[model samples]
Target chain A: MRQNRFVEKSIEKLLFVAAAIATISVALITIFVFRSGLPAMSGYGFANFLFGADWSPGNGEYGILALTAGTLAVTFLALLIGIPTGVCCAVFLAEILPKRAAAVFKFAIELLAGIPSVVYGFFGLIVIVPIISEHVLPLWQRVNPDAQTTGLSILAGGFILAVMILPTIVSISENAISSVPQDYREASLAVGANKRETIVRVLIPAAKSGILASIILGMGRAIGETMAVMVLTGNVAMLPKGILDPVATLTGTIAMEMSYAGPTHQEALFGVGIVLFVIILILNLAAQAIARKMGAVGRE
Target chain B: MNRKLGDISFYGIVLILSLATLAILIVIIAYVMRQGLPHISWEFLSQSPEHMGREGGILPIIVGTVFVTLLALAIATPIGVGAAVFFAEYSKEGRVVQVIRTFTEVLAGIPSIIFGLFGFAFFVVFMQMGWSILSGGLSLSLMILPTIIRSTEESLKTVPLSYREGSLSLGATKWETTVKVVLPCCRKGILTGLILGIGRAVGETAVLYLTIGGSIRIPTSLFDPARTMSMHMYMMTAEGISREKSFATAALLIVIILIVNSIANFISNRMKGAQ
Candidate 1:
C-alpha cells in the first residue's frame, strides 16, 4: 500500500513538471527574444528604430517604419477581402444551407486550413504572380502608364493571405452563428421579419462579438505569416505607395536576411521579432476578451 | 416587390460567395496535381537531389521531414498528454489554472515566425544545438504543444466521471484509475490529437526553415543540417530555379497532409460512433 502511494505521488510530481512546461516555454521565449532584440533597440533608440523610415543594412541604418506599414497594408487588405467573404460564407452555412451541404462546405474549409502555407505561397508565386504581371498589370498601367508593377506585389500577398485566413474566420463565425438561441430566430420571425432580415439584422448583430473575435484572430494570422508573404511579396524595403507596389513586411525581412545576417544586423532582426511579438500578443489578448464575452453571452 | 427581390438577390449572392470559396480550394488542388502528378515516379521518390535541388529527386528532403516530424511527436506526446491530464483531472478552476490556460492560448496565438526566432536564439544559438533536426524538432514541438493539450483535455473531459469514481471504489489509486480506466476509454481521442499534432508539425515551414539550416542532403545524425520538403519547395521558389521540382514537392506535401487528415477524421468518427 505504501509503495503504491509512493508511485502515485511520483506520478503527480511528474505531471506537475509536464504541465509547467507550457508556462516555462512562454516565459523563456519572451525573455530570450527581448534579450536578443533589446540591445539593438537601445543602440538605435527605441523610437528611431521603430519610426525611422530608412532601412539599409549595408549602411547600418535600421528603421522599421516601412516594414511595419507594409505588414499592416497587406494584413488590412487581406482582412478587407477575408472578413466579408468569410462571414458571408459562415452565415450561408449556418442559416441557409441544408445540413448535407453545410457539412461539405465545412469539410472544404477544414481542408483549406490543412493545406500547408508553402503550397499556398507556391500557388501565389506561379499562378497569381504571372496573372497579375501579365494580365492585370497592363490594365492598371493603362490607367497610369508610368505605374511600375509586377506579378510579385502587395496585392498578390494580400490575396494569398486572405485565402489563408478564410478557414479561421469561417469556422469561428459559423460556431458563433449556430450557437445563437433558436428562440432569437423564432422571435425575429414572429415579429414579421423575413428570412434575410432576421439573419442580417438579428442573427448577425447578436453574433457580433464572436465575429469580431474571429476577425482579430484572422488579423493575427495574417500579420505573423512569413513564408507565403516572403515568397509572394517582392521584398523591397520601402513603404508601398500603391497596392501594386512591391514592399517588405517585418516577417519577410527577417526570413530573407536572418540566415546571412551579421551580429548587429541579426540583433536588429530580433528587434523586428520583438515588435511582431508584441503586436500579435495584443491582438490575441483582444481576441480572447471578445471570445470570453461571446461565451458569457451564449450562457445568458 | 423591391423588398422581395432584394432578399432573393441577397441569398443568391451569399450562396455564390460560399461556393466560390470551395471552388478556390478545388482549383488549387487540381492545378497542383495536374502540374506535379506527371513528375512522380520511383526515381523521383528515391533519388537524392543534384545541382542544389534543381536537377534530381527529393528523397533526402522527404526523409528529413519524416525524421523531424517523428522526433517532434515523440517528444511532444508524453508532455502534452501529461499536461492535458493535469488540467482535466488535477487542476481546479482557480487563478493558477487560469494563468496556465492564458499562457497556453498566448503560445498558440504567437506566430510561427516568432517561434523560429525564439528557436534560433534559444535552441540553435544559446543551447548550441546548431541548425539541425534537433533544433527544428524542439521548436516544432513547442508550436504544436497547445494543439495536443487542448484536444487531449477536451477528450479527457468527455470521459464520464463515473468511470473514475468506479475505479477508485475498487481501491485503485487515482493514478492507477487514470491510467488503467480513464485513459483506456479516451485513447482514441488522444490518438486523434497526436495525429493532428503530427499534421501540424509536418506542415509547418517558417519555424523549421529558420531552425533547420536548409541543407539538401540526408541527415546522418540529428546534429546534421537538413531541409524538409516544405523548406525544399520554399528554397526552390525563392531561388527561382527548378519550378517543376517545387511543384512535385508541393504535390507530395499535399498528399501527405491529406492522408494524415483523413486518418484523423476516421479515428475521431470511430470514437464518436463508440460514444
Candidate 2:
C-alpha cells in the first residue's frame, strides 16, 4: 500500500516535468533567438537593419526592408483573394449547399488542408509559376511594355499562398457561419426576409467575429508559409516594384542563405527571424482573441 | 427586378467562387497524378539512388524519412503525452495553466522557418549536435510538440470524469486510473494525434533542410545527416536535376501524406461516431 503511494507520487512528478517541456521550450527558443539575433540587430543599428533595403550580406549590408515588404505584400495579396473566395465558399457550404454535397466538399477541403505545403510549393513551381509568367505576365507586359519578369513575382507567391490558405479559411469560416443560432434564421425568414437576405444580413453579421478570426489565422499561415513562397517567388531581395516584379521573403532568404552564410551574415538572418517572429506573434494573439470572442458570441 | 437580379447575381457569384476553389484543388492533385503516377514502381521503391537522385530508386530517402520521423515522434510522444496528461488530469485551471496554455499557443503560431533557424542555431550549432538526423529529429520534435499536446489534451478531456471517479471508487490511485481506465478510453484519439504529428513531421522541409544536412545517402547512424522526401523533391526541382525523378518523388510524398491524413481522419471520425 505504501509502495503504491510511491508509484503514484513518482508518476505525478513525471507528469509535471512532461507538462513543463512546452514551458521550457518556449523559454529556450525565446532566449536562443534573441540572444543570437539581437546583437546583430544592435551591431548594424536597429533602424538601419530594419529599414535598409539591400540584403546583400557579402557587401555587409543586412537590411530587411525588402523581405519585410515582401512578406507583407504577399500576405496581403493572399488575403485579398483568399478572404472573399473562402468566405463565399464558407457561406455556400454552410447555408446554400445540400448537406450531402457539403459533406463531400468539406472533406475535400480537409484534404486540401492536409496536402503538405511542400507539395503546394512544388505544384506552384511547376504549374502555377509558368501559368502566371506565360498567361498573366504577357497581359501586364502589353500594358507596361517595360516589365522584366520570369513569372516569379509577388503575384506568383501570393497566388500560391491564397490557394494554400483556402482550406483553412473555408473550414474555419464555415464553422463560424454554421454556429449562428438556427433561431436567427427562422426569425428572419418569418419576419419577411428572404433566405439570402437572412443569411447576408443576420447570419453573416453574427458570424463576423469567427470569419474575421479565420482571416487573421489565415494571414498568420500565409506569413508563416515558407517553402511555397520560396519556390514561387524568385529569391531576389528587392522591394517589389510591382506585383510583376520579383521579390524575396524573410523565410525564403533565411532558408536559402543560412547554410553558407558567414557568421556575421548568419546573425543578420537571425535578426530577420526576430522580425518575422514579432509579426507572427502579434497576429497569433489577435487570432486567439478573436476566436475567444467568437466562442463567447456562440454561447450568447 | 433590379433587386432580384442583384440577389441572383450574388448567388451566382457564390456558386462560381465555390466551384473555382474546388477546381483549384482538382487541378493541383490531377496535375501531380498525371505527371508522376506512371513513374512509381517496385524498383523505385526498393533501390538506392545512384547519382544525386537522378538514376536510382528512393529507398534511401524513404529510409531517412522513416528514421527521422520515428525519432522525432519517439522524443515528442512521451513529453507531449506527459504534458497533456498533466494538463488534463493533474493541473487545476489556474494562472499557471493559463500562462502555459498561452505559451503553447505562441509556439503553435510560430512559423516553421523560425523553428528551422532556432534549430540551426541551438541544436546544430550551440549544442554541437551538428547537422544530423539527431539535430533534425530534436528540432522537429519541438515543432510537433505543441500539436501533440493540444490534440492529446483535447482527447483526454473527452474521457468522462465519471470514468475517473469510478476507478477512484475502485481503490485505484490517480496515476493508475489515468494509465488504465482514462487512457484506454482515449487511445484512439491519442493515435489520431500521433498520426497528425507524423503527417506534419514527414512533410516538413524547412527545419529538416537546416538541421539534417540534406545528405541523400543512406544514413548509417543517428548522427548521420539525411534528406527527407520533401527536401529531396525541393532539391531536384530547384537544381533542375531530373524532372521525372522529382515528379516521382513528389507523387510518393503525396501518397504518403494521403495515407497519413486518411488514417488520422479515419481515427478522428471513428471517435466522433463513438461519441
List model 2 lDDT by residue over B1-275, tens digit each. Answer: 87688789889999999999999888888888788989998988899887888888888899999999999999999999999999989988899877777777778778888888888889998999999999999999998998898888889999989999999999989988999999899898789889988889988998888899988789999999999999998888888888888888888877887888888878887898899
| Model 1 stretches astray by more than 4 angstroms | A296-300
Classified by CAPRI criteria, candidate 2 counts as medium
Across B136-254, the per-residue lDDT of candidate 1 in tens digits comes to 99999998888888889889989999999999999989998999998888888899888888888878999998899988888999998888988888899899889899899888888
Q: What is the DockQ (computed on Cα atoms) for candidate 1?
A: 0.80
Question: Which digits, one per residue and each the tens of the lDDT, describe model 1 over residues A150-176?
Answer: 778999999999999999899889889
Superposed by TM-score, candidate 2 places the C-alpha of residue A274 at a distance from the truth, in angstroms, of: 0.6
Tell me what TM-score chain A of model 1 achieves: 0.96
How far residue B272's Cα lies from its native spot in candidate 2, in Å, is 1.9
* Candidate 2 Cα misplacement greater than 4 A, ranges: A1-6, A296-300
Instruction: Report clash pairs, candidate 2.
Output: none
On lDDT, the candidate that comes out on top is 1
Question: Candidate 1: how many backbone clashes?
Answer: 0
Worst 10 residues of 1 chain A by lDDT: A291-300
Instruction: Give Cα-based local distance difference scores for all models.
Output: 0.90, 0.87
